[model samples]
Target: MKTTNAYLSKTVNELKPSGIRRFFDLASGMEGVISLGVGEPDFVTPWTVREAAILSLEQGYTSYTANAGLLELRQEIAAYMAREFQVAYQPDSEIIVTVGASQAIDIAFRSILDPGDEVIVVEPCFVSYSPLVSLAGGTPVHVQAETEQEFKISPKKLESAITSKTKAIMICSPNNPTGTMLNKEELQKIAEIAERYDLLVISDEIYAELVYDEVYTSMAAINGMKERTILISGFSKGFAMTGWRLGFVCAPKEITAAMLKVHQYGIMCAPIMAQYAGLEAMRNGQDEVEEMRKSYRRRRNYMVSSLNELGLSCHSPGGAFYVFPSIQTTGLTSDQFAEQLLMEEKVAVVPGSVFGESGEGYIRCSYATSIEQLQEAIKRIRRFLEKQTS
Candidate 1:
């Protein structure tokens, strides 16, 4: 009989498991663990959005949508992008409704990358970026964003990662693990580099609706960037529809057509009910989205303050529900701090090193939980820090 490793693709067999899922798994087995590991919003999907999905099923509309997704939903997404992200797409030609933003990324990479092609993956980023690049038969060249730069990759650092084989650059803003968002000016700088280097930019804006202090600029909206950008977003974060798994991607028509083949073969279409829910969300879920944004803002403030007071150097992220805080003061590695804190205090956090080497001295804690849970976690963290010092 063949060995397990021999049976598997060497590419996948050699890859490590996601660090985020490992902590989430550990937390799941324990009692009374306040887990800040997963980045999902705690709010239920808005009643209106949920009702749309329910009513669709009630009306016997459970069939698969067009491979590109529902026309109505795509039109709504097109309009929403124009209004909110300052980008325009011909929904009929330049957009594809995906299973989720994650799938959009996967299809985009598979559409564009040839074997040995390179994608500049900015770090510390979501755990999936580099892996997805590899899975798509491209090499992932990581360029790190350290804490001193507020976790935003500089255009210089980005350009330095480019090579003749570089076909694309992948970015997430407001980023996961660290919630830093790049404003228009900063994005424009990267856009210039992409134009100069003739690189495609895959921008994941899953946390677009969660931004507090800065405006969320779509990468496609930057001058000369629209043609080179694959804009991916989903209803999961903005409309509290994580379970719905509805996402969309916008790109130039030619690129969209190429990605469509990958999407069609890999995922026939997004769920019809979720597409209906996404339609309702894009059209009428603004108020609920704002409400959630406000709540996350409050939690962001509280978590940042508490972590700093407890002697962990924390950055107040502009968007997203997570904070990357330094655990270096306690003289422990990110893994050590996270593991010890979880075992001793029943608080589960992901070590930042899981994101990349630059994340080694930090840990990622999500503020997607309620304030009460955050407060308790803060107390436990304080106690853990005290023990670390003593």
Candidate 2:
């Protein structure tokens, strides 16, 4: 047998398995678990979007189109971004359709990072950023954003984290776990900082369409940001097409050109059928998106109110489908709370610490589930919390 290599890359050896995976795996074997641990939307892809994929299959558009994806799909993405988000792109030179926002993240990191270069990421953030940055031979510099700040990373926090070696910053608006969105003024501040420091902005806007009250700002839309930001978005959150594996990125011509080469070698294009579905979503899925957004808002309000009534203080999220509630009163660590809730109450939640160190003392409940399920989960949590407190 070959001996395990002692000289494994420090980046590879230091990385930990995703914290969310363990809770999901433990809950998987349980028969009655009511899972709110997943980040995916509970909604299915709209009928029209599904039909479009089927139509593509029927029309024999099953073969791989191009490394950058089909031109028509790119054009539709360009139009959709312009119409909905007020961002502009050349589509042909500045965009590459990806397998999902996950792949877009990977490609962007790979294209930009060199060994020892630092990428600043705000916590509690999506779980993949650090590892992805590491895999690209870069350091992930985490700036902890407090819940007192509504989990929004301030420009001051960012300023303090930047160093001479800082190469880029990863930003996720309508953020996961926290559901905190940076408002226009915040975006302006961030853009100004990036301009001053000459840092590349990798803006993850997958939840752009899901904001409740504040208008979503694409970093690329900010003045001086179009050239300095790599904008990543997908159909997963917005169009309820998670399994479709469709996403895209837009960047300055030079950056996009570099990303396309990496994408070509790593992932030729997003799935052809999914690309077709994504095209239809951009062109005609507006009403479906609006309906889902409205339902998510209702679920958000209901769940936030219920958790607060149960004595768990929840910050009302402006976007995304999660509620991060303080569970410190139960005198349980976040992981302990989540585990007991699953094992005893048959309800699944994710611990906040799964996102980062800043996430301790809290738990994430995805309101992407239906209102009925949301109500039932909260009821279970209330009973469990009462038992624990008593």
Candidate 3:
């Protein structure tokens, strides 16, 4: 006589909701709350990109695209990859246009992972990673990239985590929540380990263009990595096109073929208008992209300096728009800090523990909002901290 969701797939039922969204939901009904938890860009999509989608709709170009997406969009993605990241992928056989980079990651795991296979999920990563791997019939092995090492996983730690069940390693450069970018040399070391273990590398490069001080390097660009790497990128973070739901996956031809099967069955194709917008974004959106990057860079500087000034030891992130600042000095756990800050100060931020266990002592504050919102959020947080000390 127990109430139950017995009809639900065990995986779906057992999976907890996104930790990022729990707090976002908590703040949704509150008035005057400055929510700095979401990682979305506050900038509007560039005019040219938005206009292209509008023009396409006006012209009645709303029919479904190829299962892999519009060929022209795919070609542009290939060209952009070659030009920006020095990675070459054949548009025809090696690319699948997806609903978002999130979908791309989902399909990539579905295509290659078998039941009981394992993927080493580098921490502290995006919230969706482990759940996606689970849904795809794979086990997610969490591996911490220590804060002392600037949130980068060392080769020794990575190798130690590998097991006979290990089939792949998933890494995000310019990582979400932390904003730590893995450079070319660091990536080369990971590539060598991947080569040694014969494990595939799923590189999420969605934030590749938002980097501030360091150069972004694609895992596939590393020597001998092109074949073993599945690169996922999209227009969401960098191009400010989140609502458009357009992203692409680049992999070896065999892998792409398998992923296309999953994608075609699950999603069929990305939206036609969104594809047009992405086409325009890659072709002529660099200047606007840079403008947004500069804004984020300026905001990042302010947040890092301000957080440090407030005694929340924060590492300077090389890229991306979020800052993970340690709140350990206050003797409060991350969850307590985020919750109390929200309740008292009406400023909403995500507790870092939601990202992964290694994120226990920190909280992630996104600098993607306006400078004004950020400044106000900081002030509110300052008042909250003073109360804690008092």
Please tell me which model should have the higher TM-score, number 1 or number 2. Answer: 1
Per-model CA lDDT versus the true structure: 0.90, 0.91, 0.94
Residues 215-291, candidate 2, lDDT per residue (tens digit)? Answer: 78888899889989999999999999999999999999899999999999988777899999999999999999999
RMSD to native, candidate 3: 1.1
Local error of candidate 2 at 60, Å?
1.3
User: Candidate 1 on 147-249: residue-level lDDT in tens?
Assistant: 7988988777888889999999998999998999999988998899999988899999999999999777888888889999999899888788888888989
- Candidate 3 residue-wise lDDT, 1-390, digit = tens: 545786679999999998888889889989999989988999899999999999999999989999999999999999999999998899999998999999999999999999999999999999999999999999999999988988998889999999999999999989998999999999999999999989999999999999999788899999999999999999999999999998999999999999999999999999999999999999999999999999999999999999999988999999989999999899999889888999899999999999999999999999889999999998998998899889
Best lDDT among the predictions, by candidate number: 3
Candidate 1 has what TM-score?
A: 0.99
All candidates: TM-score = 0.99, 0.98, 0.99
Write out the backbone clash pairs for model 1: none
Deviation (Å) of 253 in candidate 3 = 0.4
Residue 164, candidate 3: Cα error in Å is 0.8
Which portions of model 3 miss their true places by more than 4 Å?
A: 1-4
